[model samples]
Target: MSNIINREIKEIIAYGTSTNPKISLSEDQAFNVLLLQYYCFKESDISKVWYEILSMITDGKDDGGIDAIYFDEEDSKIIILQNKYSNAIQVQDVVNEINKIIATMNDFKEAHTGSYNKKTKRLLQESLDRLTDENEGNVEILFSSLATIDIHKIKSKLLGIEDRVAYITVLNKGNIEEMIEKLQLQHEVVAEDSLYIDNTKNVLKYASDQHKGIFVNVSSESISRLYNKYNQKGLFNLNIRRYIRNKNVDDGIKNTLDNNRDEFWFLNNGLTIACTDFVEDGNKIRLYNFSIVNGGQTTNLIGEYKGKNRDEFYIPCKIVSSVDEVSSQDTMKFFNTIAEATNSQKPIQPKDLKSNSPEMRSLQTLLLKHRVFLEIKRGEKTAKDINIKIKNDELAQLIFSFVNQKPGTSRSNKNSLFNNNKFYKQIFFKRYSSEVEKTEFLLDLIELNDRYNTLQKKFKAELSDQFNLEQANIFNNGKFVLFALFGLSYRIINEDVEISSLKSNSSLIEDDDFIYGPFISNYKEDDIEQKLKDLITFFVNILDEEYTNQYENKKVTSVSNFFKTDKKYINDILKTTVNKLGRTYLYKEFLEYGQIFKRK
Candidate 1:
């Protein structure tokens, strides 16, 4: 082995034996041999690089065609990479890549110009007044197997097309016989040549030290297998690596995962959430107003899509509790949360990137989490340092809301204005029916306050009917038999405005098509009075699934059962309201019901 390769091997062995070095190399000895060799390319250097890897995408997430781009600045054009610890390289993976080189050259030629081949050219460079092929420099040398590659083979095999692309190789052989023949016996250079048969045994010893012996060879072999075994055991211990990014998510779900790391995945059921509370495990992650199973949710706060890929911009999810294991349908089930992570405005739902399920989405959330944990000793008191990786993997999914400046996905700037004049009577706007603009989507929030004289009269009149009235209502309106029919709708309580129509907001917002984003359409009621029923059910279902799981996961069955009781809490909870934008509200007391029972 060359001196450089020997040094690299030393580092690999040191990685294991060093104080607490991250000894991650597999037990596969051959794999290590190839990696170390690859690291010894003539220009190779492994100094300090990145601090953390946040948003890592091996499969061109950014539309950049490179595999595994890191956040580090390459000190030189030469790059040194370490791949699988067990790969064995062959010859023709070489042929395929070589084909890519040939194809690139062909593309360069095909994109010709002016009178030369006007119609045939794909790219016309007007600046040069010629073709794009002339400007797209060269393919340059993308050397493989820096150390073990026989330099002679490169100099001989198809080494054509210079200035455009080049292939170079490095070697690591020591010819003792040829070396002795070349040394000249000069006065100063060879004066101390007292041959005492002094180095035959030492050479054998040097060839076998754990680090020095196998390092270069192992590292070398691995790089050669790049094209041959790129799909095999990759680098890392995470879930996204095994799922979405890797799986070819074609029409029908392709097996995108490498199927190599299954232990990191399993069935988790703890997914119920209400307002603030979720299942509490030591590993759960907490965001503003919500929680997610640690590493389960990714929030793109701005929602404007600062990320390069749609996958990076996940629907900001936070775990409400610990993962549960329930027998749901045929599969085990759990509730995964769609957090209330909003921008400056209303909260958004997890993007319907696809669909929700008993397993898929929850797994996606866990795969994208950023884990931060602390470890302590078995018996010692508090005294220790910390372990953190280089933050190279930053999140790519950026979030923004509907009230933003413009649609980023389009070239023509589409301003962020709703369709109604109040909503904006533009292209997508229209008139809404009384049924669609009913009690759920409120305009003003403080409608039922003590200062509103009409509130007292209306409350009394509404509460006079069949009774689901609270105990407090009985005390206030018992004076008249006609005062017991108050049915407080969330929209009325929140004081949402009632527009006769929304013909100005949505093109389809006809005199009767009630548009409430997509939520209210779930229950298309005929009468405006009946829509309140759907609003009540929406709240009940949102709470029934979310918060109840948190209550149950802790084995705190009491809170779960407490919800069934007809107590003061029910009246307090019922008094809660939401605006059309889904903002929560508190009535008499300042402590809102959603906030109060969130943990329950």
Candidate 2:
């Protein structure tokens, strides 16, 4: 395991150094970027581009213990990366770094001043400002190194102010080995155990020519004991998903255990274990190289239970094994099938079912031709060097918002978009014949959506005084609607369409047979930012004006809720926008932009 960890570290170092050799980074500097990509970002693979990785490095003169800082928008957490890529990491050094970071946070909160570098100061202040109770502000300190240290020893030295952060996770050698194992999709069994089968009770044994199984009941405590001893050692590696800790579900499990122990077996799903082989000698059954393929949640909760009656309940158990006649590949397939099938009925999201659909595969293949990886399945590994990766669900929502102009439905009922065949086909399937044409069209919309999201994040972070209250509300809450309107507004600018005609017909917004295409702009890459900003400002101001008018006339009460209704958008906002339009940014700046459907 230690050797494997060393190899992994060397690979990361090599990756970092070779990504941009011109930068001439030291081993420590390269390791900082490596940690930023792998540990801080929590991405098993390093998919970030070189420049983005370079921007995360803040380890230099006047730096405050933080080697790199990344804002994780998904969890609203500020991840501070502390890199110590050496085999001689000491607990004292780890403790000292934590104290320094705590002091830095205090200094930032009090005076918002620090001796850190300019980037560090700005990022730290921004992170600190966002650390409000309302926002559920969390700070995660990632102390990464090649060496393992006593975690309790380091935590014992911390003061009470450590509560200000969420958790300080140490990424050391053992963790590296685990990560590598997951990447390789191979879990090595580190231990094995046996169960005392009740000879007095009926133990039904089933056997095919090549496969075998046994069905019996075992004390819940026995299963819990197995989890307690080997849970951390990949005892549940074959389970479809890890034990997701849910307080409510856990409480219910405990309630059954404490108050209704007799009915536990009837209420809970039983465990399914898969092993290489099992030997039944009299009353003892020894499972060799086995893992629980299902019921991981119950196993974990039962393991955590400390009630005196934990041993009083019995749980149904099914054990499956294969003889020497079965090939290793067949055994693995059988185990994986059992894992997936058992968990498939557990409140699966609609998108999970569509991951392997024809539409998804088609889009994925089309995107791959352009050197882009479409992650149709969650946690699917793509090429490490692939710079562009898009999630299928996100792309679907983007198209629904921008092309279909159903931003409300896009947000409020995204699952339906995948569940409903008509909507799913409209978004994911292209009407065009040429794959190149389809890829280009989707790529253009993707680029526009990316720019829109970036601008929204910037506006939120900067809180520019330029946007009034109403405008800010619309910009923040009406993101999908705003993107839809931006596209419609661009069309109005370029096509020179009469707003009166659009308002009178209304089919453009209401029709189901409408075929939408990509928006082709004449502006250069460097000019896009300013143009997008100006266009956003202009559209947001109009949206605000219409919203305020509706509010003053008692037509609507809540601006946010108003934006959520598609009918309200069409009846009031769209009408007002078109009625008020004139020669705007489109005519003044560039000559033309057009919607493209085919190559010609």
Candidate 3:
């Protein structure tokens, strides 16, 4: 029994938050809440052999919200539980969750017993029909709580769900003996003979603001079941952001929380939900600072990044991720640890930015451009040569700054995005489960999706009455695609107007093809209004078969940056003399768009 329980505990701890001050609490607290739960049975439960049987479903969303299924293999019944830990608990939230599980289960069963082959289809007919009829899934919910919960309200809600969902609430204040006795008094589920725990820390350590440990308001069985599900399925682990669901609101909360969430975590976000704060830092000292902007523009703040604890003032940074993980083994160059102690733990102003290193120069230029990241580390190592320690320390600051800043830098996007995705097919279509079937399926799907996309784009543009030099994207929810292509090339097909943006000093539209703005101003009094209208009409009517023959096959491939690598036969017709109305920055948009696309 000890083996099973101990293994479960170990897994939880390994994946969960640690009391050690060095770990990223956002990652830790998520795992911490599930660690303290256990399923209990007397030392003689027979079906204990089936202890390993667990149920779990992978949610498309990446948050670690794993719904667990625990059941005795020998029995013909199943129990599903949704477990979560937070200081605040709402009864309505639980009721809504039970409904979601029922829907998911129904969908799963439908997939399982649906048509496979003729024989299987016949065999699964009854199942298919039965499964199609949604089951009012009676998964027992063991809603756990880590705080001093209001049980009266909880009991009332649980009774309302008595015919279906089961609720279990565990308060923070309860002795092991009391907890055990309470479990015995409740209804029993299938369990194993093995159950054991060693010297457990009753008091979970928190860096500052919240609880020391995650309270188990749910069942231990739920924990064991969830662990096994993850193990058996070889889960890649869910990320925090997918579950949290990013939005503009999240960013606002993020700023406020970073300054107050913890003495330990110090930064708001996800890590370190609870903390009995130690010496406070930025998260600790209240910043009564705000700038009065002229008019009603949003204001900014100026203050020293006071230590909320070791975490707040001094944060490390990774070039890509917003949350920084602390690790000694990951030490290498590309680290940018904070040198907060020397800077009086001051917040970085627009001016605290000077460096001698070339890499630092790169970072400085990037910062000046207000790209997404701004890094400055000490100890004279180039990005590749920087020690891991320096990297870890700077990582936190990088995350904080990136998270706080609006629409961060686009220069150093981490994800790989080839323009073609292997020419779209190469990027999107890979080896499917089976070549014949998958290829047919994907081809059909892609064609359909393309049609839908094209129509969607056309509808959008027609309604908006907006058209530019973008390529094929003038058809769907492909504003970016159109913007990108337009910045580079111009195409004309009858009334299907091709738009061109002037990125360089300027370029004139061909005799036929609608040209958008940003024309360079070459003369003081060029008849601009009449010239533009005349040019728009002239380009539209001039489209001809000869123009298509000359450049139709040429593809505007992105070479480097937003620069295009394409074979284009520029026509002298489009190069007719023009009084430039303005300087063009059309290509610059493509540059920025490329950077943004890379990030997504």
Candidate 4:
């Protein structure tokens, strides 16, 4: 083993044996801490990373060898993690553990129903519901160990045992060392001898003291070598869109490479490479800090065409190098711009461009004035001035739930919602048109939502059984109560004496002037404290009525199903109640219930 690998192994061992109050010998706790540290090393946002880790902890012994699980809802992939923190583990033991996991997943429903913890059972069932034959290839089993083992030999033995799985990988000391090296590389701006290209057959397209552009007619074999050397670590790191494995595109590339090598350049937009510096000597061009900002498909295809018709093709490439004295931030910005520009031919998700957008940057700056950190880029945790940072993904979800008024859509399709056009065209684009207005609007909305979440938890603990409803309703549909509170605020501000005016202005609830200027300005903390309980009581009464109605009409067998089936009716009732009662009557009713469920 290399010294780096030995060092990492030692670190893991030391952490495992530490007597810190937070550390524990339990397998689940140890694995959670270990994986948390691993992802932390990968530079994931600490808050979001901890959220994912906590979500996966099953909290019991009968976890069926599954320490933690993550479902990449976007890719429709399930990542099953198993960690063994030991100095030495036999190959057979590892193989047996993997086989056991495969069997358990194969019979997921049965295994989960038997003796597993409630949390793991629910997670397993939800995961099984998401998996179908079409996405069976998305399952990834990762086995991690502190020991050094021959991965190739183990993979050979485990071949074909679960052919349906996407793939399996073993994370040992070598893999940990590679991860550490990648992390280190992320901090450096300059690289030495980063790329190798031939100079004999290629021509210099443009040359200057500060910039150089070269056009190369390179063989697929050489391109494959370049990809093997750098692509895995961070060659296309700046590209916003990740490479999706498309069989059709791969086949087309291979066909074109085999049939028409000369026409490949015309038919395809050749690769665009950026480098900090390079030097040409004899037949070789050595590049520094080189990254491919475009042509990910072509690079991946070249790697795939490794053994078949590999040498029969040559593709064109455009290599651009710069030696100008630029700051690291400017260089990163330049690369990000190139990445966004080059990927125009492919479909880009909203999140792909949102980080660098002018609106987001303006909002980020505005948020900083309030001591709130807004993270525009995913997995970025560089904001050091605040205790809580709101990630772009989380902000998007909040916008979807609050502004778009589709909390159900946000709940079911959390991953897909950010990429959808409606989120951009209907909500984000409209709200961000006026930066100051939208900034205040979002700040108020987040504050209100946070308080609502806290009150919902308290309600569940204190009154869930008394209300005679499932605890799930308190967790899932609590957003409806928040929406009702917004409507109530409008009623209070308008002082229309009749609730009918609220119906016309209900759409105006999302309006910034209506929410921040009118509603927030008029209400005090004590008013909110009283109104929150009233809102909860209002929702409870509506749910109780719906339960009785459903039970009498035989429309549902369980009271929980009432929330699922009659959500529209519940919303309509809440709206109509606010409309009929007006602000004065509602305040009177709140005072009546105020003395009963008085705030602690």
Candidate 5:
């Protein structure tokens, strides 16, 4: 029904069908390929994109009602796609496909794997295994079509499915059109009138390496008008924290404006804007292609208190425009650096400033040698070579676990821990002369923890009779168990006689010495694998004992609340458990017996 969407879809189909001469793809098959291109982007390397798309497509005669599938790792949600390319698609047809996908997901493991092609079968099995092992039940069933279906009728037919899934999204012709529009916006040239600031005063100038900086004070009314014009668009596009309503910081900004308007400049950190080009005329400056990389909260709060405050308040702003012609990548790096440096003065996490660091680049390059991807920036593109990538938040968790020896704290307070000044200072400020060695060790430790997590999930699934593992409780706190394992590894690395000898022999343990030395010597391949299994089993037993004690005594009110709110209580528990199991019991078991705990 949508002419724009139909035109684009037809173009894609024509290109796909014409390009592949050997294989005679059906219209439906070509449609599936177009859908893959639409979501993944055709500009990506063909071999890499095709390899991924081939694994997702199962549109043959005995297909399991799923045309394509994508797992969003960052959001922990599975997107099961059902494509109807025809313009005559109906409500009943769409409802039937939705039901089929739901049935397939419900008994995915027991489905007829032979019906699917080799690639589809392998992908399905792996995806289902990961979902079950990680306990990621959130799903999104997207029914996309070229035709416009009756929204009310479709909703009536798919009544209870919403309750089953996290949510169902219908990507009709309009949705596809919007996606195309957004993609086009990314490549479009900026217009002259796109950027505007009003009533500027007392403009002064300075210079940086390749940028000219202008400092000015603008009336609060003009700032409010500027914010109102570009409220939720791309004004503060580079700000780490977007405008969050009713936050304590927002309240504080409002209070300062209301009570002490004269001291506003002293109270606030001011705004930093980055522009590709700008024009100055007396007290008014018109920026071009500008983004507010800092002071997002101040901007939003000014807009919030626009009418309440008298016209006496003034806001300080710094506009840094590129003076020298540079490549887009270099410009991006420059603005990102400016945002990072300016925001360091405010309360922010280390990860927020980590993207532009030399250490991050070094780690990224080092990890690439091992076919690992280190994502220093949020929403950065993944490498085509590696399937697994580690983001900043995950890296922060690993650092917290290693430095603090409290995995529970890292897991429960993951967001808050990154913002904690003490934790951030401890991790980032340390010397990394042995960057590669420490990175390799940390990567292995992360893999080990992942294995422990998988085992915990399997155990919980098998023993569902005792208590609901999905429920938030101390007994089901997998992070606590993971921290215990980290504690054990910490002690082993620091105190093991073999590890000490290896450390003495080399400046630091060589990659090869990990096989025979103290740090991971016992953990070499099969030996370490079996020891991890036994360690998880022992911890499960300890968890059972703790659960029984808590149930009988009713000492804790809510396990989730206790772990999240009371850091001292969780840290105390971690210390007591590590002292008893990790230092005394598990330490002796690992050193003397190696994998002997399996027999016990």
Candidate 6:
């Protein structure tokens, strides 16, 4: 193998060993993981865990020459992968593998009793059954070899088999190398110091105090080439809804480029670019540090297009930039404003607009030290060092649901949490005196939320009693409320805190050492989960008592309705429980509940 491929293989092995040391695999198995990770599942929303990927391997005896098989639920497709971990693979080997898969698919379709392993048959049968006409089930055959092979030759050999498969992708060493190169580019920002814009058409220029722009018709082929080179490298960083794939829209764009070239300029909305500056030469214009803030879908379609008449058409283009020599606070804000105003094809939420705000960027920087990634852009790449990818809206929801103690609003008014200036500032505008302390406090909330979700899933799957099942339903619906209650329980245990103290701005809440140090930080994951389960049991009983009281007075109808209404009544119940039972007695009750569940 070449040095680069060898290095990649070694890295994959190292990562697998590091991430999951209990399970081990050979180099061939590791290579399969690498290929599937980057090629089949990277773009699609599939599990990227090493152990999960390895679990899909059915490559033992009677495997039918297929290495790994996965059902991509996001795209509703079946992926059949065969990897060749070698530097010199024969063309016949590729053909034999494809033929084997074709036979296997036939077996699946006919329910034939084949010699394939039971695991492979079961997986393939189930996956094939999901691909009906209503959902447009697709089967993707990926034949990847470490050696350089003639893909066109292999494709030509499979000519009449298009009816059996949706599409076949054959990748050789060169293709893998190209994929690796693009993967590397996803980690870094790529800015073109100078790009030539076609100036053959009428170039309308406008100049303001600090803004400069041009309206022109740039060739689609040029845009396509630039997109091909810089698409993964921050080409659409400024785009609010970056490159959502709609098959119908994509086919329309490609069809027009292929057949209706003359009407392309009139049919589609032009691209809107934000740049640092631009200069016009004789027949070309040069743009620096530019990003496509609009027309992300059109640009992506054209970039990956295979139409022959791609170069025969031009797209309407509008490029805007600032004249400031140095990037200032005002200049960056200007760029953000332009990005917000130009995106109109897809509905832009208020949170989407705040992705580039100073507060968001500051929080992102603060969290990076703790290995938490704040994904602001729609499809931005997560850096290599990131341990977690929290979307901006997710953070907003978390803060509102847990810290602010408004679980109902967190669920129903999520957009308002970002849309209302006061709410947005309340959640994100805090300047942490100590970043590490603040991060740990927030991380604990995330941990609690995760444990709550896991227990909910267990209740859904394992519990059988009608009352418990009804409670589980309430648990699922009022998850955010339960999340807030968990935090409230912790605060109550630490001190005689009131309900209003759960607000994010409360000094008692901000004092992480005082609030989180003694109890939550002292438990292992198993212990935390047990404590959370017990807390939920105790809270459920309290909620029942409060609901019965209110129902007798004709104030509330049901338990779920009791949890769903305004949080004030819920807080009053919690306060009454803490005051009636006393913090010490309630703490003992939590422990007793834990012991009961443990015994069960």
Top-TM-score candidate index: 4
What residue runs in model 1 are displaced by over 4 Å at the alpha carbon? Answer: 16-22, 26-47, 50-152, 159-600
When 2 and 3 are scored with TM-score, the better candidate is 2
Q: For candidate 2, write residues 10-86 as lDDT tens digits.
A: 66666766755754666677677666655545454664444445655678877788888776654456888887868
lDDT of 1 by residue, 1-600 (tens): 344434544654554444235544333332233333222221122222111110121221222121221211111121112222212333434334444434533553464222323211211111111112322231222323323334345444544633243222222222211111122110011111011111223221112221111001011112122212221122100112111111111111111112211211221111211122122222222222221122211111111112232221111122222233223321101122122221112212222211243222332222223221111111112222322211100100000011111112111111222111232222112221232332222111111111123433444334333223222222231111111001122223223323122112321111222223222223333432223322323444433343335334632222212232222122222222222223333222222221211110
Off by over 4 Å in 5: 1-201, 244-246, 324-337, 340-477, 485-520, 523-525, 537-559, 562-600
Candidate 4 lDDT over 1-600, as tens digits, reads 457644544554455465245544454364444554553224433333433455565535787777777666555667777777664887887898888778767666344356666566656555554554445446677787767888767887887764646557688766665655655454332254433344474566787775667777655666677776665567766555535544345557778877776677677777776777666655556667767778888888776452344444556677776658677777777666666777666545456676787767777776677777888765455666763467766666666554455544444445565567666555456554355555656666555556666776656435544554333433344454345444344435444223464466554433433332223423444667556656566656655565456545756433323332224433544455555455676657754533322211
State TM-scores per candidate.
Answer: 0.20, 0.56, 0.21, 0.59, 0.45, 0.51
**Model 3 residue 274 lDDT score:** 12
lDDT for every model? 0.23, 0.67, 0.27, 0.58, 0.58, 0.66
lDDT of 6 at 195: 42
TM-score of 2: 0.56
Clashing pairs in 6: none
lDDT by residue (tens digit), candidate 5, 227-265: 776644456656644443333455577778878888888
True lDDT of residue 333, candidate 5: 77
lDDT by residue for model 3 (1-600), tens: 123323433444443233333433232232232322332221122123111211122222421232344432212124444544444556566555555554444444555423132222221121122111122232333444333555456556655454443223333322222333323332111122111111133222222231122211111232233234331121111111111111233334335535543321233111111111122122221111110111010011102111232222221111111123324223111111111112123233222232343434443333233222233533333433321222212322222112111011111121112121222222223333234433333222222223334454444334233433222111211222222232222222111222334212123232223222211222234443333223322222222222333233432111111111111212221221111112245323322322211110
Candidate with the greatest lDDT versus the true structure? 2
Error of 3 at 285 (Å): 60
Q: What is the lDDT of residue 450 in candidate 6?
A: 53
Error of 4 at 413 (Å): 4.7
Q: Candidate 1 vs candidate 4: which has greater lDDT? A: 4
The all-Cα superposition gives candidate 6 an RMSD in Å to the true structure of 13.7
